[model samples]
Target: MENKTNNYSYLRFAQEGKECIYDLFDAFLKKTIIEDRAIDFSKSMTVGDDGSIEFVTLEKDGAEVAFSELVGGDPSYKSVFELYLRRKACKAKDQLTARLALACAHLHWLWSLGMDCKTSCGMYGEAISVEEHWMDSLEDYNRESGLWHVNLSEAGVKQDLTLVFAIFHRFVTWPTRPQFKSVNQVKTALVEFVFKSKKNSGAPVRNGLLHLCDPDKYINWYSFESKTMFVTFHSEYLRGYKVSDYSELLAQDSLYYTRKYPKGMKLDPYQANRTEEKICYIFDRMEDNMPA
Candidate 1:
């Protein structure tokens, strides 16, 4: 029922999604180094410029090992880990080294399970995606659904195995931090709060990258006719911005409110928030129409 071959080669790749070297390290961080069987995560981090974290030391059973040396022991993870260190060592767009590695890894794990993984590259603060923007940019030359190309098509298989796991981690996992009970709730919050903002109509703006706009400064441009952006994020864009900025926005608000209603009086007790989405995994493949 499960393919636990090659020390779970396929499953590990699917779990981490090659988002970056950090993600790969993260998997082991959850498993080897920090996982209870051998490594415990009672480690210290030394922060570098721009909030970057460097693993300093790991303590276990009163034994301390240099973090870098501990990582070098694993051949599978060690290779890429070395590369990440080299990138940091050279200072090449050094701040974005992590981001680019995450991007380059892309969604290979998702692709492995036979899904058309769509990705778009843009500036740092840009919206990585907006379905509205993607659809509007179709050119006339295309036929059949007006899609430009077929990227992940090798034919799909209806193979289900126990150890194999996959997911759309960001879209699915993000709602968790925001406290939404389900993905649908996240969708509802987006539709009610963001999609209808500033025009209440889904007006398509090319380069619709969600640059953060202060509600007070851009009220005329950001405000929906009747609804206010009550949540931390502005209308459609999800972001984790600077503390000073977030703090300022919250203080200026008659927008965000707190209600002391009894437990069941609330709107399903579903809260919403967003965090930086680093990985997306595809846990299953059950159809033959698509390709991997």
Candidate 2:
């Protein structure tokens, strides 16, 4: 059962984790606005001393209705908002389910090869490993231990799958968790746990698992360049970034890929390519294709 209000309440918060009037307005605007029409904020809006959007009035057809009144009277806005929330929740659920399936299969593949975490970590990028770089590891695991061939009979694999489920479950239910004030807080803890020590032997394993959970947010951490880029440039990306904003961007990206690519042509049939890598690849291609 999904709490539909999870995204609704989260959209109310600004980047600093404080609720913001503009953010709330933006949420409605995003869902309900017509592309061709623009609200003239100069006359139709009011700002408070605290920098909040104090009031709004929308004008159309030579008439004006108070935005607050429209919101109060219109059930359509509520319907649209709820619809959007359901779509977001559905996408999130799908992402989690597919990732969990892959994780279970990956763990089974490792166990079948008589590999513990230690052996898998040591054999990163090797032929007989599922702990390799992001792209190939997923391919290998999906090819070898797909749900059809996955073995849950092994006690060790079952134990590891339980732990994986717990970690992934924390993220799925994080919206209602009191300790995590926002997704950013949960993401911060994830970053610390996943990439805490670069030299740690389990770095590859940690990276692969986290990436499996959320490719849009988590980078493939085994590569040195990925770590360097994250350390150097991730903060710049975070400027003015809210958890809600991140979610919306993901929705946009997902939509773009869905419209542009056929199912089999996608980079990873299971999930989106890691966002960091895609951005860097775009930059490199732009440079290479430049007309000198």
Candidate 3:
């Protein structure tokens, strides 16, 4: 039994060492190719207004160079090589293998964009893990050690699966406030915000403002104005309107029904105020409608 255990350990160590060596060699070869092709990649050529390159003819079999074909390649290759380096540096035997895989995938995207893969820089943010509990539903795993272990009991696996679904649902439903100038821009921003926020927050929760509108839809502006006060609803939907249909109404005409309350409307035995009296009446009505 002792000899068998020692043989198994030796085999595992050999396999891991071989994988590490192959990865290192692959990284080294890519770096060499990029360095060798550095100079010819930096040449810039002028492009004409007709989207044509003056001296260069791009051939997909045979074609002319266009304005869009004028990018330098050296920086692009260098960026990709650096990305590989960053990914390799982040991987560790003690860390969750699934998380490391996710980090590697993120590095691929960063490499394509010439960006570096990096950890989040704020409180309560955790790096994404790709282990079976987070990646697959068939395994039980502990995150405390940062490594994913497989072959979990049926009950343990079920609990982990439930936790995963709950997290994903909460992430999808989180609200994103509008912070862009146009409604469409705001929608895209919200989608990105929700994705990042959900990844940061371990458990998914509904976003407070997720029901506002479809991100792809256009919104019209609406405003309400009285003589002394202007209350802009931006749109009827924002004001809790559910009818789904409304005709165009001019802002100036919409203010016609608003009564011209005095600017200094007050309530006292010495002063008479209709607006204050109406407001008080509305509050009393609201209080009366409250459930015990």
Candidate 4:
């Protein structure tokens, strides 16, 4: 019996070590794939047939976890992992993941347009990770450690992205969720904790971050004037639209993961220019018809 117990322990150790090795190899392959398919700056980025912005994704055996069993079904934890996996595996089905993909796609598009400095800032904000490398952060995440002690020793102010990174780190490493229940609540709390003063907060940048977290509940208009225009010219669209800053809506999100259709996140580069053209068309018509 003693010898059998020793053998079992040895086997378990060996298996864990083997898994660690596999994870390292997987990371190497993913990096190689991304490098091999590096976007040629001389050529324009294109959209995929699925209507998502073309971004690199690891084409590996997709893994599925029931929504109920995901990160123990903790809404906050689930959201962080969802974004991470969606980016890593191109899987995004839930509201948060979907919005993240959309926001990143739009931000990337804006980057391509050189619309303004904010476009470039927002793009880097979404792309950055908290560690020397993103996979390092994933590997360093220890649930036993709390937010203050997570693997953010290398963290920096990534413009508005500082808030996004802080949120991701908090959700993934924090042992427990804060009392907040909504995505904005999480954002607001993180903003207070991460930014030293309100002066550092830019409305479009911060609000855009909020929209990325929950598109149904928040709009990603780049300016307050744009939001006002949408409200003034399209009041009926927002008549009953009470933006709730909570996670209750996450329950209604369409979520299913399979090998064929993993999470549904996308990041495209040219989408911003197209969206801008449509907005300009609307403005042109409004200018001709509406009183200033």
Local accuracy by lDDT, each model = 0.24, 0.32, 0.24, 0.31
The top-ranked prediction according to lDDT is 2
TM-score, cand. 1: 0.18
Q: After superposition, which runs of candidate 2 have C-alpha atoms over 4 Å from their true positions?
A: 1-178, 182-184, 197-199, 210-214, 217-292
lDDT of 4 by residue, 137-239 (tens): 2333222221011112332223334333333343434566455543345544433322222233332344333333333333335343454344346443333
Off by over 4 Å in 3: 1-186, 189-204, 208-242, 245-292
CA shift of 93, model 3, Å: 4.3
Q: Give a tens-digit lDDT track for model 2, residues 199-233.
A: 21322344444433233444434333344444345
TM-scores for every predicted model: 0.18, 0.22, 0.15, 0.25
Deviation in Å, model 2, residue 171 alpha carbon: 13
lDDT assessment of candidate 2: 0.32
Task: Name the regions of candidate 4 deviating beyond 4 angstroms.
Answer: 1-158, 177-203, 224-292
Expressed as tens digits, the lDDT of each residue in 236-256 for candidate 1 is 232332333465444534332
Candidate 1 vs candidate 2, lDDT winner: 2
lDDT of 3 by residue, 187-275 (tens): 34433333233232221111211111121121111111220121221222123322222232223223212233344653111111122
Native-referenced Cα lDDT, model 3: 0.24
Report the lDDT of model 4 for residue 64: 24
